[model samples]
Target chain A: MSKGNATKLLGAATLGLMVAALFMVFVYAPAEATQGDVQRIFYFHVPLAWVAFAAFAITAVAGLFYLWLGYPVFDQLAYAAAEAGVVFCTLVLVTGSLWARPIWGTWWTWDSRLTSTFILWLLYVGYLALRAALADGEQGARMGAVFGLVAAADVPVVVVSVRLWRTIHPAVLVTREGSHGLADARMVATLLVSMVAVTAVFGWLLALRVATLRAEARLRGLAAELLALERASEEN
Target chain B: MRAMAAVLLKDVVVELRGPMTTTALATVSLLVLVVLVFAFGPVWGQSEPTAAAGALWVALVVSGTLGGGRVVAVERERRCIDALVLSPLDRGGLFVAKSAAAFVFILVAEGFSLIVALLFFNLAADAALARTAAVLALGAVGFAGLVTLVGAVGGRAKGRDFLVPLLAVPLYVPALIAGVKASADALGGARLGEIALWLKVLLSCDAIFVAAGLLLFEQVVAGSE
Candidate 1:
């Protein structure tokens, strides 16, 4: 199949998987004993968090690869992934707060996970800002790649430090680990299927974003060539 | 190694030759401490150490932000950045030289700030004080490594005075949080082991930022766009 067709197929597959996931999340998975139905947000929230991490991992790896190989394409990949990562990270925070408000009786708390997530958001937002603040070509890309790699590499340290800084997380108040250890096979399957679905969606969004960037770069190149020709003709 | 040492030695010589950035920040640090003292409502109270810790870190961070980026700025202002870029020194070695030199200046300013903080706040001069000093040293290493690199890029921006702090502070949060906590623990008479986690954070941050500075120094110190 052609590349466009393949992309179309992937999108359709994501949609199908998402529909299946919605069924499993609502119909298949059993409600928790304590939190009841609001607990269902866990499936989406956790998967979104996972995708955020994965997206950032892609950004970091691509950034480092760009630095080593000096390829504009790698930098492009890193930038695209960072944009997607930031979007997913925002979803993670919003969904997490939503979940927290219903179950933890508060809209927000300075728990380690939440705080680390917030900082992760800040770092990437800073990454985007730094990218914008610099030259728009290879120089900016190079600087951004450096910042991306450094910031991503520092994430583990951030998590550890934040956790050490605050130990009283709401996780202690209520258990949300692996379906609350409910051991219900259907519930487990639902969580797994949902994770797969969102991950697929994440992939699709990443590809779309990258393709847009690539096209934009191509157009910019064409425009620059046209302008250069125009200037030469005028000078002659 | 020789190139790196030469770069460092040059900075020290240049600094010692004149008052430059350090002397200016010393005065600023003292003024900041006075403001902090007033805000904390007299530091000689029962909770002086607690207030003193905050004052100390803020002073250190402020002084650090002002002085950290200026070394590179002065180089740029004097067209020394171009010379340094053209030099035969390895970029990583240049990074090492710059960060090491920046760390020394930062240490001096921090020492002065610490004295100012202690005298004004009337902080205790016991074992806890020694521990806090150690925390300051460890934290400064990481802070210096980061600000040196950040300052290199940030000092080039049109709004560098703002940009340098904007770039440096986010990266400094982890170290600052850990350092402040550890300082509090020390001042509260907690044993070293009890504050081990905070110390670990500081150590890891220091190591990571130093290694990162070394690796990415090439990108930072590259020729103009």
Candidate 2:
């Protein structure tokens, strides 16, 4: 199948699953007696967090590939993944904060998870800023790739922050006992569906971003070639 | 290794002869004390001894971060970092040397800051307080190492002054929390074993950041250049 067709399929699947998940969340899934409607936010919030983590992980792996292989494509892929990860991570923070407001009685807390997420946001923002600051393309990509890998090393720090420090926020999804412990069968089914849907959306978004980057690169290369030819003609 | 030590010794001698960096660090420490005094005036007056320990530790961390954060920018602006990189010395060695220099600079600054805090806040002289200073030293070394590495990376970026703190502070949180808790316990006359967990956490963080900085220094320095 063509790239465009694959993107369309992914996009459709994402939309379909999103609709199904929403219906299941509101209608089929029972609302928590404790959190009530706010509990529903978990369906989207948790999946977005998962997608964000997956995106950063992919970016880091791609960065390692770029450094090892010296392939511009891998660098491009890493850049695209980092951008998507930042976006999703930002969404997770905003939605999580909003969800916390009524339940936790505050919009923000110094809980380990919240603090780690905030740090991750800063790391990626700095990553993008570093790229923007560089005048040389190769230099920018190499610098960003290095930073991407280094920043990815901090992921474990973020993951363990909750366990190491005292936090008011309970581990909702991925507990020490695993997801199987906290979530019942029906909740698990809904969560799994949501995760699949979110993953599809993430894939579609990354493909589009990668395609755009590739197109931009091609245009730049063509322009450089054209300039070289013009200079040769003038010399003749 | 000798070349790296030579560079480290050069930085130390420069700091000693001119003492500008050390003086600046001392000044920042004084400024931190003033801020803490003002912010926690009532608490400062009521619990001067206890507050002094906490304030001193904080001053040390902040001053150290600022000093270390400028290490690369100063070298780069002088075009010395390029020369250093071009030399036969290993990049990891350069990182170690810089971090060591930073650690010592911060220790001196913290020493001066502690004196200032004691003078002004009238903190009691106690064995526990002495041990707390030692713990602060360990914490400073770790903090300086991490910040120096980050500073080297951020120095080449735009808004580096802004970026360095943004990137460094979050990473330093765990260390800061652990260090502060350990120091607090020690200052309160608690046994070292009482704060053993926090001490272990600080040591682990120090090891991790040092290893990471050493391993990644070449890439960051070369790429930035």
Q: After superposition, how far is residue A145 of candidate 1 from its true place, in Å?
A: 1.3
**Native contacts retained, all candidates in order:** 0.43, 0.21
Candidate 1 root-mean-square deviation in Å: 3.1
* Residue range B1-225, candidate 1, lDDT tens digits: 888898989999988999687787677778888887777674457877767777778877888888887877888888888888888998888888888888888788778888877777667678888888888889989988888888876665556787677767777778888888888778878878998878988899999889998888888778643
Off by over 4 Å in 1: A168-179, A231-236, B9-20, B27-47, B153-163, B190-197
DockQ of 2: 0.40
lDDT of 2 by residue, A1-236 (tens): 99889888888888898899888778877776666777777888889999988888888898888778888889888888889999999999998888878876678776667777877877888777777776435666777787777677765654464346554246443321231233556777777788888888888889998888888888888999999999999999
Colliding residue pairs in candidate 2: none
Q: Taking chain A by itself, what TM-score does each prediction score?
A: 0.92, 0.88
Evaluate candidate 1 and give its CAPRI docking class based on DockQ. medium
